[model samples]
Target: MLRSVLAVALLCWGADGAVTCRNENDEPVNWYILYKAPHLTSQALTGLEYVYIDSNVMRKMAPSTDNYKDIKHPNGVLANTLRPLLTPIRSMPNNFGFISYSDQPPGCNAMDTFGHSKGVVMVDNSGPGVWLLHSTPQFPFRRDQNHFWPESGARNAQIFICVTLGYSQFSHIGMHLQYIGAFPFEHDIPLDFHQELRDAVNWVKSPPPNNLRKLISTDVNQPFYSIAKQQSEQPKVGDLYVTIAQLLDSDLQVQTWGCQRDRKPSYCVSGIHKVLNIKDIHTVLGNWQPKHDHSKWCVAENPNNHWTCIADVNRATTQYQRRGGALCFQNQRIKRIFLQVAQGTDDCSTLNIMDTIDCEPDPHTPSLMG
Candidate 1:
């Protein structure tokens, strides 16, 4: 039944109509998540290999053969979904619009003041679009460049969450991006579209004075919550994970760039909610420490809450002074996948880990400060 619906939707779109997130097989999907593994062993991994999960996988509640693919492959999920924007065309339709933003843009120096966000938002005037939130820097290069992925992105682990939303949701997304201080390297929002998108593009030039912004998006069948925080001069109110843990009213297990200098220790001071840092991850490829992973995400500790978020910032002290955000949702399967990978945490004594296996340090990997 799911295949039939997707096939019908594909037929309706007719290959070149509305922009949507495509699955591994290039089929249109409502949403998808990809976890690109880092180059753990020089002999086996390329760091471009990733595990994929989409609306179909969620429906089945089971892993599939197509769950794993190469990010550099032309027929892979990343290439399949981004072909419309990256490939050159004689003339673009009037209804199509897009925005590519990143703090570390290709052919440019990384911006410290802008949001640490990176993603592409593509929408059609007819009322459907896709929002791709990711952790890879300098990715999906400017449309004019005709390059989809960057070589530098393959060196570290990354996470990407893409959702297909209706046109009405773009305004809310725009507002969230504005709050995060997103730096749009390339964009084209038609005048006929919502005014907030134009404002988002303009916000990059003249940022607002707001420290944080939050919004709930229900334009689609599912509900998505977004939270954005700007670079604060003081650490008075800039711990993104802590704020999210409090907002959801649940303890969290977070993963981020652990090798960064001045990395903050796991937060257990909040009596109501504790944010523990994930130190080791167990994926299909193999087990690895946080030193080899650069993905940023968090999952609710309690199974009942079922909250999962893919974020753009790290748990490092320097990151607190930078703009960033996260897109969150409540999903049982998604939450489970994130939870299972958390084999060990900074405060392992607080949680039960009798069944967890510690990953041995790789001899080939260079030592880095954590």
Candidate 2:
């Protein structure tokens, strides 16, 4: 019943044609997650494959594709990077705002200190649009220029997750940016004039909030949290986490369980099956077809527990010093993908490992320290 309702909503929403995400082929997608595999994959074309997943059920884990349909301009994300900007003011929902920020914002230098989070936020005045988060640096290109991926960023595997949501939920997102101290870049899109938007923008410039927060992105069915290093309470929500090593926050005194944020093992996650990419690196991505790729994600080994998440930072070193975060959910299809592709860890030499009955530590993570 719920699935049917969501399907109907998606159809109506897609038909509106107010916004469309350009995929690898420059084809419009209701939403899509593209994983630009790094060179470590086991296949020949091996390191490169794009995973396209959208709101439409038929497109679920469609196929492994590297061939792009557009080159004259950036497709996937770069092409439709400024959908909100294109909206006719008269056609905008009662309230609509698409806000974008980057340390390396177009027409400006990258802000040295800012949230490590990178993505697009487009919500109707009443609240309906997708938040596109990705690991690509110097991307989304310039709003006016043709979108193109930087050669520097192309070598590493990158991931993108586009989740669409209704309006009310953005208030929580506003609160998150407040906690992360994410400021609106010089090129930032003006947020809604409403109080909630004001609060988010103000929080970017003000002092810290009282404590940590756990909020859910209802549209995507994923829950996200932020733990400020300055706060007294420790990072603890008790769920498995995942991200890449380069983006880890290393400035803090991060605890080591068994799964280390970086490869050092000095920062370990004691018992849980800290998913690794050490083995065959080949798994069923879609149609259960064998595909090799470099995408960071997590899944509870216990199937019934069903905790699957796709993220950017690895629990590696120096991440504590930087602001970082990840969001997870209990969805069945998302769970299967992460779980099937999960790689188990091998014994490490650098970090000290103490055996304990418990492996899964209370959910604690170091995130954007605004």
Candidate 3:
């Protein structure tokens, strides 16, 4: 089984030396989630299929499975939790630290205004760390390109969660990547760590007075929560799943990038809290649509509100006028595995009597309306 999960993750390396989040049987984990599955039909599409869960199989709730895995399986679990930042920075450990943002970064050219976000944080200056929020776009490929995974992220469906916090939760994940203006093509953050990780590696030339920020994970006593937003040209009082359904008071369903362009529809608006929008997913490696999933997430439609986010914008209206955030938590087994892969949505009485709803495009996605 992938070489016995890389021989029990190399016999649980450095036992308590920190830096974790490895499970796919590779052990160590305080959190984990990964979905990946997309590339629907081109025959044997090698988009490195996936599906995994952790925190000890969500404390034994586990069951969902299509039996996938292959994210460059050299003892997978994303290559054994990115083999110590793809090794060789002089054999590492001068109290390491890292960052790796992305707005489609890899070889570069796609940062428009930044903050569509993607992550990788690392850290370990004597305390622990791992944070890996994601939605993939030219991913994990620039630690001198020692490569970890990415072939243009194998066409669509993506999602990742990671989390293992510590070193003072990376200064609230470097001020939530400087309130999401995140575009650090690569980073190292060392000068004795936290200056909000050198202001999130120079948030695209400085800019974090906050368009939104929220924190709460108290350095991994764990209950995680983080929000971040910024990418404005105007339009920001609410959007980001209506401020995550009024800050987790519940009611949300979301899932994003469903054939972009203007999108937004399904926020039932009456007294707040109700974000809907999903529209067929049914996973276990099967059903699709939503133009072949580009995975942004949400969940917490009551059932005693066990929240669960994992975002990077895309309810679209030009992504709520741009920029993004999300990384909530309050797991009820990760909110029933993202509420059983949703199934359908877009209600609100069909958008309160329709005024335009067409969607269904994906001729291999491109035109987000100029």
Candidate 4:
């Protein structure tokens, strides 16, 4: 069955074009964004309900819906993304590899120690791997499981963003993923996929840094109790650099951080700048997921800002005490599109992105008390 699937996929590839994910119809796509309708109400679709936004295939951005109103049918997009992997090694291209990373990976990944990051990555020698960031836990099962995302993941709202580029760009992605301690499907990664990360780390740490512009949002998922005690300093995560064409000020990146609703646990927290208080409707997506979920993402509240970012962390009473972050961008088309879905914001914050830099003196914190 797998062999036949690969045969059909090989026949489908344009060969002349770049390697990317397919759309709802299994057609070639340049760049695509998927929003999995959350299982909020009992009527919502179950098991990875996908709302696809493929720029190449579907240019018009639609409102964030809870079902297959966007696509004629809901053919698991992630499943199609992993299809080509099953193709025989000999028939494989030397330039590409796929890694399915998640908090709930194929095995007991023991990822509890890491951040609250979950997603899939596929890189090719041709360019940087496409990182599909999402909220699903155990998903995109192993070959033995028939290469599919399980229904167990359909209980909540989820989001997946896939970006493809050259090897140089992926090196930057590697640096960010490393910050969160994300690995390619754990030790189960194949040899072809190994070089992607090895090369990325070596390249990023090399003398001439790529310094590529991209967003690296994530949730560290550290407990407030541990932070209150002297057990560990705050998570030392990296800040993403923004170089959008319309946004002139370097300070814009600082404002995007404002969207984070929680206060910074310590100075070692992610990003060197401050977090902003974003009330813009764009970021205020209407219960964007099953229960106002997929905490990390960026969005442009107004045209004056000309920037948008969707993150995976929330600053609500419960989540503010947790850990997470998001990536931002100045791309007009993307910014405008996401703005349309600006339904509502799950949580809100009064602290500016910059203000969150310093840790609030808390009696629970041993250092603060001492």
Please give, for residues 91-203, the per-residue lDDT of candidate 1 as tens digits: 34556678888876776745576777788988776757889999776777544323577777776788899888887788878877787888888887878887778888886
lDDT of all the models against the reference?
Answer: 0.71, 0.43, 0.68, 0.42
Clashes of 2: 47
Give lDDT tens digits, candidate 4, residues 100-193: 5554564444233444456666666554345666655555555321445554445444566665455555555555555444534532233554
Model 2, span 1-370: residue lDDT tens: 6544543443333334444454544345445566555433344333334555554443255546444432224333445534454433333343446666443444444343554455566665443555666655455554443434444344344567765555666676666555444545522233544455566545353333434355544434455443332221111221113221211321111111223323233224544234333332333332111112223454454545555445433343333434434444456676565444444333334333322222223212111211
Q: Give the TM-score comparing model 2 with the true structure, all chains together.
A: 0.62
- The C-alpha local distance difference test score for the whole of candidate 4 amounts to 0.42
Q: Model 1 lDDT vs. the true structure?
A: 0.71
Candidate 2 lDDT score at position 212: 35
**Which of candidates 1 and 3 reaches a greater TM-score?**
1
Q: Over 4 Å off in model 2, which ranges?
A: 1-15, 19-31, 39-49, 58-60, 64-82, 85-95, 103-113, 186-192, 199-263, 266-296, 347-370
Give the winner by lDDT: 1
- TM-score to true structure, per model: 0.83, 0.62, 0.32, 0.59
Ranking by TM-score: 1, 2, 4, 3
lDDT of each residue in 1-370, candidate 3, tens digit only: 6544543453334444456777655667777788777776743444567666776655432323445347766566766676667765555555676887877766554555667778888887676678888877767864432366766577667888887766876886787777677888877777888898887787633343433344433234447777765444333333687777776777888887666656667877678777888887776556665656677888988888788889887776665555668888786777887788887677777652222244444433334431
Q: How does model 2 fare in lDDT?
A: 0.43
